[model samples]
Target chain A: MVKKILSVAICAIVLLFVYAPILLLVVYSFDSSKIINIHEFSFSFELYKQLFRDQKIMQILFNTVWLAFAAAGLSTILGTAGAIGIFYSRKRVAKPLNAVSQIPVINAEIVTAISLALLFSMVALYRTYFSLIVGHMVLCTPFVVLSVLPKLKQMDSNTYEAALDLGASPAQALFKVVIPQIFSGILAGFMLSVTLSLDDYIITAFTKPKTFDTISTYVYNAVKNGTNSSTPALRALSALIFVVMIVILLVINLRARKPANKGA
Target chain B: MQRFHFSRKQLCIPYGLFLALFVVIPMLLILFYAFTKETDGNLSFSFSNFIGFFTSRAKLSTLLMSITIAIISTALCLLIAYPIAYILARSSFRKKNVLLMIFILPMWINFVLRITALRELLDLIGLLESQNYLNTLIGMVYDFLPFMILPLYTTLEKIDKSYLEAAADLGGNKFTVFTKVTFPLSMPGVISGITMVFMPSMTNYVVSDTLSNFNITILGKLIDEYFTTYDNWHMGSMISIILLLIIFLTMLATGGFKDNEKEARGTNLW
Candidate 1:
C-alpha cells in the first residue's frame, strides 16, 4: 500500500511539473493583472479578443496550419509507401533500408537544415514554398515510417498469402488485407508527421519564402525584437493550444484502449 | 525491366537517390566550398576558408563556447531525466499512461511555442533581466529534455523487470540496484537520448539566438550569419563543413553512433 501510494505520488509530481507552466499560462491568460505577481486576479477575455483581432497573428496561424497539412500529407504518403515497400520486401534488404531511412531522425536538425538550404540554393529552389515542403517532407517522412513499421511487423505474413490463395489479386490483397490491419498505425503516423512539421522552426527559418511565415517563426521574431508587449495574447494562444493537445491525447488513449479491450 | 519485383536491389534506388541528394551531395558541396577561394581572376579551390575559421579568434571562441554549452546542457538533462524515467519505468501506478502523456506532450507542441513559453516564464521570474549564460543553458535543457526522456523511457520500459528484482533479492539496495542493474540495462537508451539531445543542442541556433540574444555565438548562428547577412557562400559552406566534421569526430570519439546502431537493432526487435 505504501509502495502504491509512493508510485502515485511520483506520477502526480511529474504530471504537475509537466503541466504547471501550461496551467499557469492558461490561468494568466485570463488574469487581469498585467504583471506576473497576481495576489488578486479577475477573469477577462481581453487577451483572447486581442489574439483574434491581431491580423498578423491570424496570418501566422493560417501559414502554420497550411504548412502542417501540406507537410503531413506529403510525408505521410511517402513514408507509408516506404514502410510498406520495406514491409513487403525480404528481411535482409528491409533491415538496411530501415536503418538508412532513420538517419535523418537521428542526425542533428541544424546539420540537416543547413544541408537542405545548400541543396536548395544549388538547385535554385531556395526561398520557395517548394523548398520548404521538400525540406519538411525529408525531415518528417522518416518519423512516419518509424511509427508505422511496428504495425507492419505485427502483421502476419500468412494473411496476405491467404488473401492471395482466395483468388484476391495482389492489389486487392494489399488494399483489403494489409491496409485495414494498419489503419491505426497510419493515423498515428499522420499525427506524428503533422506535429513534427508544425513544430519545425529551424528548417523553415532556413528555407521558408520571404513572404511566408510559420507561427513559430512569427512568434520567434516577436520574442527576439521584444517590442511586442501583448504577453496575454500569446498566453491565450498557448492556452488554447494546450487544450487542443489534451483533447488529441485523450482521443488517442481512448482509441488505444479499445483495441486492447477487444483483444482481451 | 524484366519484371517489377520488390527486390533488395530495387529498393536501393529511392533510398539511395534521396540520401545522395539530401545528405551526400550537399556535404560534398560544403566541403568543396570550404577549401575554395575567390581568386582575383577566377574562382579557385584553396584552403584559405578553412584556414581562416581556425585562425579567427572570435569564431574559435564561439565554437568552444557552443561546445561547452552543449556538454553542460546534455549533462544536466541526463541527470534530471534519468530519475524521472526511472520512476516511470519502475512504478506500478495508476494513470501511468497519462503521466507518460504529460511528459511527452511538450514535444508535440511547436518548438517555437515551447521556447517562447519558456522565455516568457523566465522573464516572469526575472531570469532574463541579465543575459545569463546559465539561463540560456536552462532553456536548451528544457527544450531538449523530452528528446532525452522519451528514448530513455522506451529503453527502460523494455528492460526485464526481473533484473531489478534479482538485484534487490541479492541484497542490493535501491541505489545499488539502480547503478548495477538498471543503469547498465538502460545504457542504450542513455546513449540514444544523449545523442539525440546533445547533437541538436550543440548545433541549435535558434535557442541561443532567442534566449541568449546572440550574446553567445554557437556554430549554427555563425553559419547563419555568414550565409544570410554576408552572402559569403564560401565562408558559410566552410563553417558548415567544419561543423559536420566536428560532429563526425565527436561521434567517433564518444562511440555515440555505434551504440546508436546497437540501440536501433535492439529497438527493431518488436
Candidate 2:
C-alpha cells in the first residue's frame, strides 16, 4: 500500500511539474491587466479579443499554419515515395541512401539551419518563400521516411508479388496492394511532419523571407524587445492552444478506447 | 529481375537527388565556407576562421559553457527520468500508454510557446530576473525530460521478467537485481536518451534566451548571433563544423550511429 501511494505521489508531482507553466499561462490569459501577474486575476477575454483584432498577429499565425501545411504535405509525398523506393531497392543502393536521409535528424538544428541558409545564398535563392519551404521540408522529410520504412518492412512482401502474379501492373500492385498496407505509417509520418514543422523556429527564423514572420519568430521578437513587452495576446494564444490540446487528448483517448472496446 | 532493378533505381532517383542537393551539398557548403576566405575578389583556402574561434576567449568560454550546461541538464534528466521509467515499466499500470501519451502531448504544442509559458511562470516566481545557470538548467530539463523518459521506458519495458525472477531465485535482492541485471540491460536506452537530450540541449539557445532573458550566452546563441546579428558567416560556419564534430564524437562515444543504422526505421522520437 505504501509503495502504491509512493508511486502515485511521484506521478502526481511529475504531472504537476509538467502542467504548471501551461496552467499559469492559461490563468494569466484572462487577466485584464497588461502586465502578467498571478495575483492580479480579474476574469476577462480582452487579450483574446485583442489577438483577433491585431492584423499583424493574425498574419503571422496564418503564415505559420500555411507553412506547416505546405511543408508537411510536400514532405509526406516525397518521403513516402522515397521510403517505398528505398525499401524495394537492393541493399547496396539502399544502405547509403538511408544513411543520407538520417543526417538531418541527427545533426544539430542550428547547423542544419545555417548550412541551408548558406546554400540558399550561394544559389541566390536566399530569403525567399521557396527557401523557407525547402528548409522546413528538409527538417521534416527524414522523420517521415523513418516512420514509413518500419511499416513497409513489417508488411508482407509476398502480397505485392501475389498481386503482380494476378496480372496487375507494377504500378497497380504498388498503389493497390502495397500503399494501403502502409497507409497508417504514411498518415503518422504526415502528422509527425506537421508537428515538427509547426514547432520549428530556428530554421524558420534564419530562412524566412524578410517580411515573413511565424508565430515563433514573432514571440521571440516580442520577448527580446523586453520581458515586459510580451503581449497579453500571447497569453491568450497559449490559453487557446491549451484548450485545443485538451480537445485533442480527449478525442485521441475516445478513439483509442473505442477500438479496445470492440476488441473486448 | 533486370527490369525490376531498373524500376527500383528509377523510383529512388528523386530522393537520391534530393539528398545530394540538400543534405550532401549543404554539409559540403558548410565545410567549404569554414575552410576558405574571400580576399581581393578571390577565394583562397585558409584556417583563419578556425584560428579566430580558438583564439577568442569569449567564444571558447561560450563553447565550454554550452557543453557544461548540456552535461548537467542531461544528467539531471536521466536522474529524474530513470525512476519514473522504471516504475512505469515494472508496474501493471493499465493506462500506461495513455499516461505516456499525456507526457508526449506537450511536445506537439509549439515548443517556443511552451517555453514562453515557462518564462512567465518563472517570472511569477521571481526567478526570471535572476540570470543564472540554474534557471537555464531548469528550463532545459523541463523541455527535454520527455525525450529522456521515452527511450528509458522503451528499453526498460522490454527487459524480460524471467531475468528478475532468476535473480530473486538466486537470493539476489531488489537492489542487486537492479544494479546487476536491469541497469546493464537498459544501457542502450540510457545512451540514446542521453544523446537525444544532450545533442539538442547543446544547440538549443531558445531555452536560455527565454529563461535567462537573453542574459546568458551559449554556443548555439553565439553561433546564431554570429551568422545573423554579426554577419560573420565564415566564423559561424567554422563554429558549426566544430559543433557537428562534437555531435559526431558524442554519437560515436554512445554507439548511436550503430544503433540508428540497425534500426533505421524506428521513430526514436517517440
User: All candidates' lDDT scores?
Assistant: 0.74, 0.83
Q: RMSD of candidate 1 to the true fold?
A: 4.0
lDDT of 1 by residue, A17-80 (tens): 5566677778888864455554667788888998899898788888889898998897777777
Quote model 1's TM-score for chain B. 0.87
Tens-digit lDDT track of model 1 for B1-270: 686654323533564466567766766777776778777857797888878989999889988988898899999889878877878876677756556656766766766766766666777777776866977787788778777777787789889888888889999998898889889988878877767677677777778877776577788888888878888878888887777777777777666774353223122211
> What lDDT is obtained when candidate 1 is compared to the true structure?
0.74
Deviation of model 2 at B24, angstroms: 0.4
DockQ, every prediction:
0.36, 0.51
Fnat for model 1 comes to 0.33
> Model 1 off-target regions past 4 Å?
A1-17, A32-41, A89-100, A230-232, A258-264, B1-19, B253-255, B258-270
Query: TM-scores for all candidates?
Result: 0.87, 0.94
Question: What lDDT score goes with residue A165 in model 1?
Answer: 99
lDDT, model 1, position B21: 74
Instruction: Compare the candidates by lDDT and give the number of the best one.
Output: 2
